[model samples]
Target: MALVKVQRAAQITLPRQIKDAAHLAEGDYLEAELTSEGILLRPVSIGSREPSPEQETEILAVVDQERKAYAAEHHR
Candidate 1:
């Protein structure tokens, strides 16, 4: 297995071997999940009209974060 480091801003650069084996390319999208073992990433195709479940989850997460931030700032 290849090893990778989480960089600043929580970004990770996939190793060349891993990218080649997975047929990943720039502009490709991946769905990330937390499993019992570790983080899981799977390549997914997104439709132009409909958002994938993973994307919806990500959107909700972002909305939740923004709402909390706004509430904190406005309340104080």
Candidate 2:
């Protein structure tokens, strides 16, 4: 087991050994979750390529529309 200190902004620098063992590299994404014992961290990739700026805008617009529709339906 390894001990690490959380720095400012709640960031902890993963030990070099851990990174190398996990085959992690720069720009890699990690998914973190709280567990009963402690925090769990795992690498994740949403897709082969990241969405473009226009796609992000469209996705947000769809989410906003769905939220408004749900609110209206429930606030009857």
Candidate 3:
């Protein structure tokens, strides 16, 4: 497994090998989830229209909020 460091703001830089293997590029969208084993990351293709950076940030924020809510409900 490739090791990656979480930088400031909880950002991670994907290793070159992983990027090439996954065929990921700059501006590509990824869907992340908290799974039983660990965090899962998958590439997301939104048809032909790619969201702007601001939109992507907003989407991720909403996702994070939902994830936190779910975890809170289940962890009690």
Top candidate, metric lDDT: 3
True lDDT of residue 59, candidate 1: 71
lDDT tens per residue, model 1, 1-76: 8899976445689999989999988867678888999999998876643577898798779867866875787678
Number of backbone-clashing residue pairs for each candidate, in the order shown? 0, 0, 0
Candidate 2 per-residue lDDT, tens place, 1-76, comes to 8999977435589999999999887756677778999999998774544657886688669767866886787679
lDDT-best of 1 and 3: 3
Error of 1 at 13 (Å): 0.5
Alpha-carbon RMSD, each predicted model: 6.9, 8.9, 4.8
TM-scores for all predictions = 0.61, 0.61, 0.65
Q: What value of lDDT does candidate 3 attain over all alpha carbons?
A: 0.81
Worst 10 residues of 2 by lDDT: 44-53
| lDDT at residue 62 of model 1 (Cα atoms) | 82
lDDT of each: 0.79, 0.77, 0.81
Order of the predicted models by lDDT, top scorer first: 3, 1, 2
Best prediction by TM-score: 3
